[model samples]
Target: MSEPWTLHPDRALPADPATRDLAREIYAATKDLPLVSMHGHVPVEWFAQDTSFGDPAQLFVVPDHYLTRMLVSQGETLPRLGVGSTADEAVETDPREIWRRFCAGWKHFRGTPTRYWLEHELVEIFGVTQRPSAETADAIYDQVAARIAEPDFRPRALLDRFRIEVIATTDPAWATLDDHAKLAADGYGERVLPTFRPDPLLHPDRPTWREDLERLAAASGVDVSSYDGYLEALRTQRERFVAAGARATDHGHLFADTTPLDDAEARRVFDAALAGTVTAAEAQAFSGHMLFQMAAMSAEDGLVMQLHPGVLRDHASAPFAAFGPDKGYDIPVVTEFTRSLRPVLDAFGHHPRFRMIAFTVDEDVYSRELAPLAGVYPALRLGAPWWFLDAPDAMRRFREAATETAGFSNMSGFVDDTRAFCSIPARHDLARRVDAGYLARLVAEHRLDLDEALDTAVDLAYRLPLAAYERR
Candidate 1:
């Protein structure tokens, strides 16, 4: 007989029973609250078309780098899991075979959060009580495929079922937002929104920097060759995103360096950036200026700004060369936030209307840099542990590090930041559990009261993210 597969009763709870009880209470209170995902990478067209999901493999396996990356590490090729190849000839031949291969490799995720989430999806979402294996693969696949074909399995339906109050999608500045416009026209405006992500346009060091700039110019119908023209183009595009129900601007830079360059210096760097000859320092300066400019735009437009820094995207050159960005090659690098953000903080950190949520890949800076800054700066808030650090351990560490100094108000609850649509509820569940456990520890240690713990738990689970990213 197969080993009895079950999620632990004490999942994400503290080891101590008393703490576990408190954590359980905290989790139970906020577990059913509506999910407010303020930031993510889900395509807007999914809701725009309100289309039915194709298959289990396509819906669950193909688009998620988290699952595919692990499978690839185990020598399972991406093609076997239905990850489409850039080369036209290499697409997976059969979806059923991909499902079988994925099931065969499911054991690799044992004891992982991904494993827990997949199991939850199988059990709770698909009602598949049996464990996934070579034997159960086809049965589970057929069940999910049929379920997805039902009317209630549509994207909007799933959103409503997931108790998601609102979800925001990240898009480039050049994005037409046609799908977002369609969603608003269809009267789903209050449910789904766009976020302005200016990385490709702002990062002068990006591979296709010049081409991207020209594309931005064409998309916005504003000449980008001149500095003044570029500002007009960015303003026009930001207004377009704002009109389409966007509430925030996302900036993912290598670091958090925000200093304004003098016009002459800025113009020189802009010229070099357009010519694709800017140095790393010049690129950094240009990005910094753009961030300050974006902040000014946010102040005017009431769009919250989210600064997610310290991600070394495409750490491996070979896979990036073969597959391009976000093929699970990104790695976290050590980041200096106190000094790096000083320039920006000096300018707008105290502004009443200016709001920025700071996310870090460098965990070491949580207590030392991020907490102290957010504790004092009116404009700053700490984003939840993101990407590499969104796991159970990291979540606990973040609370332990940041809660005392910055407290619950200075933290922006939890944002899943996942492309795996099915994992959304599971990811948020894990966060709620981890936070409950963290607060439970505080209560056990006499650091906080039970009632206050309950309040903090609810804030961490429900209120803070919306307050951080919602329209001002």
Candidate 2:
């Protein structure tokens, strides 16, 4: 049998011996920097409660769409992986069985970022010695379970172990933030922060729109019976997030269009939505207008605006119907930001307090649209490769394509946009290595001095995120 799982120290570095040496130095310098996670989807309750991380399957398999989607593509049912579409659905109940299924299909994740992160978690976090497979699954599961039983394995303790200086968890606009309040009272509010996410309230076409509006009204204590009242409720919720130490607002819309409708038009559309008579086209327009409003509000409030566009959430109906959203069905569609964002960009793109980071899964826009748009706009910067494109090769391509036009300063250092809490360090470590390799190539080519490359590497890994996520 092959040797037990081991990660090479030089993995993800440049291939050439000379360039690889330079990258090694850079990576060594950057590999241990304090983690500053400004944008992510980590569950807030983990740190708020500071509880044990449960079993191996629950930690690594159940909630990870990246793992489940690949297994699903290989013809394994989600239910067999313990991911039933609904609570009442008949599914695998044994965590060991789920672990076996994941381990047996381990080969399917070859060459993917999921493999890189999982291996890091297994080896570095859990002291796992064997590569996952049906044969080794039981042994590894026992090892991980023992580690989870340790007091140091709690979520808050892992934050210290992972060297995370600060992390922002995505929260709905109307969220009570009770968990966040708990963390704040425990004196970790600054380390574990909330991020305002108002996507649901902005999408009036959604089946749950009215229901979400009522929730917003109740949470914000603002009546949403009128269009102006709805706006006030959103603003009020944003203030609540700011009070909870939120540094940013996150939007994952399907389009980048941010054209503002006149107040009359906006009110008319909102009224139509309330009356249940809004057309699909009006709903889309209203969503775009809301984006404009979000940008405007960010300009006033100084919360960094994070815009992620061009995703068709839940592309497959069967799995979605069975397992619900974010079970790896979200797929990327073509996105254009240059023309689509002109309305908002023209207005706030130069505003001193307006700061925006544009993230897209569409690599085509890295050089053509986003880079140039961010290059000239004082308020805009290109975010790191996100979602489907956060892999090593995609990250390298992002630096290559966008750096020419936007340059390094205009890029938001690596934003680890993930929902998996344990994978945070792994994700950042991978980014640092990819960036070290990229900067090493530049140094070897005489395009940059080693000193300059080293400084830039630190910026990409540490300083840039602090600045990017800082209030402008």
Candidate 3:
């Protein structure tokens, strides 16, 4: 007989008895604090429409790149996992088969954060008792499907159940934010907000740059034919996003370079990009210049600037061509921030209205570069371990590396940059546990008092994100 699944009460606490007790105490104190999800990729339409989730497979497997990426790595095809190339493409028709495949590959996720979150969802959220395996797949799927079909399992109900105080969804530069408007009409405006993500508009080398510019023009009612006009349109859109309750703007650039250029040069590059004659070097320079310009806008408008660079997005072209972007192929390249950001830091590092949160997939920069930069710059703050580095060990390492230089106040608390709505609480719970344990270690070593550690735990879990994102 297979062993029954259970989540230990002290799952991520320290092994040392005294420290474990301390960690448990700290975790218990902050475990139920309302979640402040300042940044994420959850679609706003679900909350606006208060839709019911379809099935276990759709909830657990279909939308999560973390799970699908690992499954694809183990030689399972995306189509077999119900991931279609396009919206119209036919994917795996049977959700039961998809669940079976996921169960068969379950062992592969052992020791992964994805496994931790999935197990938490299955056991704590859905009350699944059997460990996922090929033998238990059908029974578990039927159980989860039955639960999802109930009225209580709808998205809005889950949001309240999860105690999500606020969740900011990433939206395109040209997005109308109609769903957000609907939520406001329904009186959920403060709870669900839009975040302006203008990556497609910033990169001139993209094949769709001109098309994106036209869309921005239409959205902002400002002609983006010239470089100045492009800036005006971006500013207009940022104001619109602010009106829609956005507290920050998110950028996922190739690097953190923020050197500015003269208007003539910027205009030249902009015209070249529009005419489809811009070189790769010119595109890079223009992107860097635009980064500085974005900071300028943020300083003027008080929108917190979130800069997370270093990912080489769409690492594999085949998957990107077959499916659209964000199919989990983005790989991290080495990133530097200290020197690359000096130009912008020199300009607005002390600007009163500016607040910049820097995130990296490259952890080496945590202690060496990012920490020291955020330590001194009044405008700069270190975003919590992001993307590939938001796991148990990585979270601990981030605290160790960043705390000494930047200190706790300079750090942005956990953001749960996730597309999987069900995983939000699990992810935040993991963060709270990891932080509790980290703080417990500090107490055990006589670096901090128990009361201070408890306060820090609550800050990391709840207050820091709101302050960092300027959510008030």
| Model 3 regions lying over 4 Å from their true place | 1-3, 85-90
Q: Residue-wise lDDT of candidate 3 within 129-212, one digit each (tens)?
A: 999999999999999999999999888888899999999999999999899999999889999999999999999999888899
Cα RMSD of predicted structure 2: 1.3
Instruction: Report the C-alpha lDDT of model 1 over 1-472, residue by residue, as the tens digit.
Output: 7665566767778888888888899889888999999989888888999898888888888887778888888998765677656453376868788888889889998867788789878877888867888988898899999999999999999998899999999898899888888888888998899999889878788888778888789889999888889889999999988888888999888878777888889888888887778999888888988888888888788889999988888887766776777864687778888887787788878777789899998889999999999999999999999887888888888888988899889999999898778889998989988988988888899999999989988898889988998677
Candidate 1 has its poorest 10 consecutive residues by lDDT at 80-89
Identify the superior model by TM-score, candidate 1 or candidate 2.
Answer: 2
Clashing pairs in 1: none
Off by over 4 Å in 1: 1-9, 86-89
Predict model 1's lDDT versus the native: 0.86
CA RMSD for every model? 1.9, 1.3, 1.6
The clash tally of candidate 3 reads 0
Candidate 3 residue pairs in clash (backbone atoms < 3 Å): none
| lDDT (Cα, 0-100) at 414 in candidate 2 | 85
The estimated TM-scores of all candidates read 0.95, 0.98, 0.98
